[model samples]
Structures are given as structure tokens and as C-alpha cells.
Target: MLTFQPAKPNQLDAIMTIENQGFTPDEAATKPSMAERIDRISDTFIVASQDQQVLGYVVGPASDERYLSDNLYDHLTANNPADRYQTVLSLAVAKDARDQHIGSQLLAELAKVARAQNRTTITLTCLKKLVPFYERNGYVNEGVSDSAHAGETWYNMVKTL
Candidate 1:
């Protein structure tokens, strides 16, 4: 059974492997950045595992900002329970786990956490091709995003709690 739980420091290697596979070099978070997030925002950073193997993860920090800024990609702050918005920095499933709804499940888990915290919305930015996937998961396209991360265009996606 796949279970959702807080990300731990020991899962860093698995998380980094999936991160590299799911995103391009420029777009993927570095080891150090991932480490910082794991240490500082475990409350919002969750992983899906079964039989002691991590299959996927969804991570981000709570924020007052409604949209993701490019700076957030490199700099992260600890989650503040009082923040009104929950932002998804990454949502990735292992290659072998694709087509099994793991990504959607991860998002659902994050939504549960956000709702419980009384957050107003969950926000994320995705490449053009992934916008539809996020849309099906309940996020609305807010058109082109100003984020210049990875030098690629992104669309703002938000789901109101």
C-alpha cells in the first residue's frame, strides 16, 4: 500500500534521483536545495512510499504570496503555519510509477494538509505541457507566469481550498 508521510533526511538520495529524472538539469532542484527543504519544510514536504520504497513526493513551503517567484527556486524559507497559501515546488513520481495516479495522489495529500491548515489556496507553476495534467487535478490555469526559472515558460496553476 502506498502511504503518504513526511519526507526524512534519509530519503534524500531517492528524492534526488526522482527529481533528476522528472526535471531537466536547469529546472531540477540541487542536492543542497533539496536538503534545505527537507530540513526546513518537512511539514509540507511529503513522500509516498510502499514496502520501504519511495515512489513519489510533493514538496513546498507555505507562503503569503499567491504566485511563485523565480527566487523561490533557489531560496526557501521554513513553512509558517499562518501562511495563507501553500505552494508546490515539486511533484514527481518515479518513472516506474507513472500512469498509476501517484502524482494525483501526492497532490491530494498536499491538499489535505493545506485545507487542514486553513490555507486559501495551493499554487504552482508548470511547463506548458504539464498544465493540462495539473488542471485535471483541480488547478486552474492563470495564464503565463512571469517565472524565468530554467529559461522556460511556465503557467500559474492554483486550486482554491
Candidate 2:
């Protein structure tokens, strides 16, 4: 059975592997950034694991802003229980695990956490190609994003809780 839970320190390697596989070098979070997130926002950083192996993860910090800023990828803070919005900095499934619904499950798990924390919405930025995938998972495309991350165009996707 697959389980969804807060990430643990030991899972960093597995998470990094999946992250590196899912995103390009410019788009993937650095080791330091991922480490900080695991340390600071474990409550909001969820991992999907099966048989002691991590399959994927959804991680971010709670924020007052509705949309993500480029700084968020580099600077992460602890999740504030009182924050109104939940931002997903990264949601990645291992390449070998793509055909399954691990990504969607990770998103659902995050939404559950966000709603329990009294958040109003969950927001993220994605490359144009993945907009429809996020849309199928309940996010609305809010047009082009201001993000210049990886020098690629991104779309702001939001899901109201």
C-alpha cells in the first residue's frame, strides 16, 4: 500500500532523485533548498512512499501571497498554520512512477493539509505543457505567470479550497 505523510530527513536522497529526474537543471530545486524545506516545513512537505521507497513528493510553504514569487524557490520559511494560501514549490513523481496517480495523490494530500490549516487556496506555477495536467487535477489556469525561473514561461495555477 502507498502512504502519504510528512517527509523525513532520511528521505532526502530519494526525494532529490525524483526531483532531479522530473525537472531540468535550471528548474529543479537545489540540494540546499530541498534540505531547508525538509527541515523547516515538514508539516507541509509530503512524500508518497510505498514499501519504504519514496515515489514522489509535494512541498512548499504557507504564504500570504496567492501566487508564487521566484524568491520562494530559494528562500523557504516554516509553514505558518495561520497562513491563508498554500504554495507548492515542487510536485514531482519519479520517472518510473509517472503512469500512476502519484502526482495527483500528492496534490490531494497537500490540499487536505491546506484545508485543515484553514487555507483559502493552493497555488503553483508550472510550465505551459503541464497546465492541462494541473487543470485536470482541479487547478485553474490564471494566464502567464511573472516567473522567469529557468527562463521558461510558466502559468499560474490555483485551486480554491
Candidate 3:
């Protein structure tokens, strides 16, 4: 049995584990970065858990526009905290815990919150290889992105709310 809930402070260690496992060092959301995201945790930040173990998590805040190549530090720091468009900053699951719809479930929960908040759209960037996965979930690829994470090619995707 899995439960989805807003992220809490203690879950950072576990969440970081998954983030590290699912992404490379360059692409990984590092501890400080993850801490920053936790600090910025809005109603959008969420975790997937069963019993006391966290299996996955996702988070995003509202923003109107973004630059494709900017890293989180640059992009987020330049933003007005009051930005109104949502960007799915991180969506990661434990390696052994994937293939169980956790990602889809997280996205569904995020969508519900977006609608309740009257958000304009939900947007994210993924490697070009994962474009089809997002497309399967109704996200439209707007264009290729120039990512700050070297060697990674991203595709900007969005789903209208």
C-alpha cells in the first residue's frame, strides 16, 4: 500500500538517496540543492511512502517563464518567489521501487493540486530520450532545451491545466 503526502523535513535523507540513485552526479539534485528545494517546498511538494519508508517524491512551484539552459541556482534565484506558473523541479523514485506507477501517481497528485490552485500549466524538462514517456501522459514537447548539466539534452514539455 502506497500513500502520497506533502514532504516533511525528516524525509530529506531518504529522498536524497533516491535522487542520487536515479540520476547522475551532474544531474543529481545534490544535498544542498535538495535542501533548497525543501526550503521552497510549496503545496506541490510530495512524497510516496509505504509504512515509514519513502519510495519516491516530486516537487514544483509556480513560475510563468524559464530559460532552457539555466541551472536551478540561477533560474530559481532570479525568480520572484511569487511566480505563478508551476515547474516540476524533481520527480524521482527509488531504483528498486519504480515500474510500479509511482511516477504516474505523483504526476496525478500534482495535477490535482494544480487544478485546485488554478494553475496555468504544469511544465518540466526531460532528456530527449524520455520525451515519449511524457507524451504518453499528455505532455506536449515544446522544444529542445540547452541544459546546464553538461552532455544532457533536455526537451521542454508542458500539460495545460
The global Cα lDDT (0 to 1) of model 3 is 0.78
| lDDT score, candidate 2 | 0.93
On a 0 to 1 TM-score scale, where does candidate 1 land against the true structure? 0.98
Q: Write the per-residue lDDT of candidate 1 for residues 32-87, one digit (tens) a residue.
A: 99999999999899999999899999999999999999888888888788899999
Candidate 2, superposed: residue stretches over 4 Å from native: none
Model 3, span 27-138: residue lDDT tens: 7766877776766654678899999899999887667665333555344443344555667878888999989989888988889877777776788889878888788888
- Total backbone clashes of model 3? 2
lDDT of each: 0.95, 0.93, 0.78
RMSD vs true structure, all candidates: 0.6, 0.7, 2.4
Residue 71 displacement (Å), model 3: 4.2
After TM-score superposition, the amount by which residue 4's alpha carbon in candidate 3 deviates from its true location, in angstroms, is: 1.1
Q: What is residue 66's positional error in candidate 1, in angstroms? A: 0.8
Residue pairs clashing in model 3 are 62-85, 63-85
Q: Write the per-residue lDDT of candidate 2 for residues 73-155, one digit (tens) a residue.
A: 88787888778999999999998989899899999999999998999999999998999899999999998999999999999
By lDDT: ranked, best first = 1, 2, 3
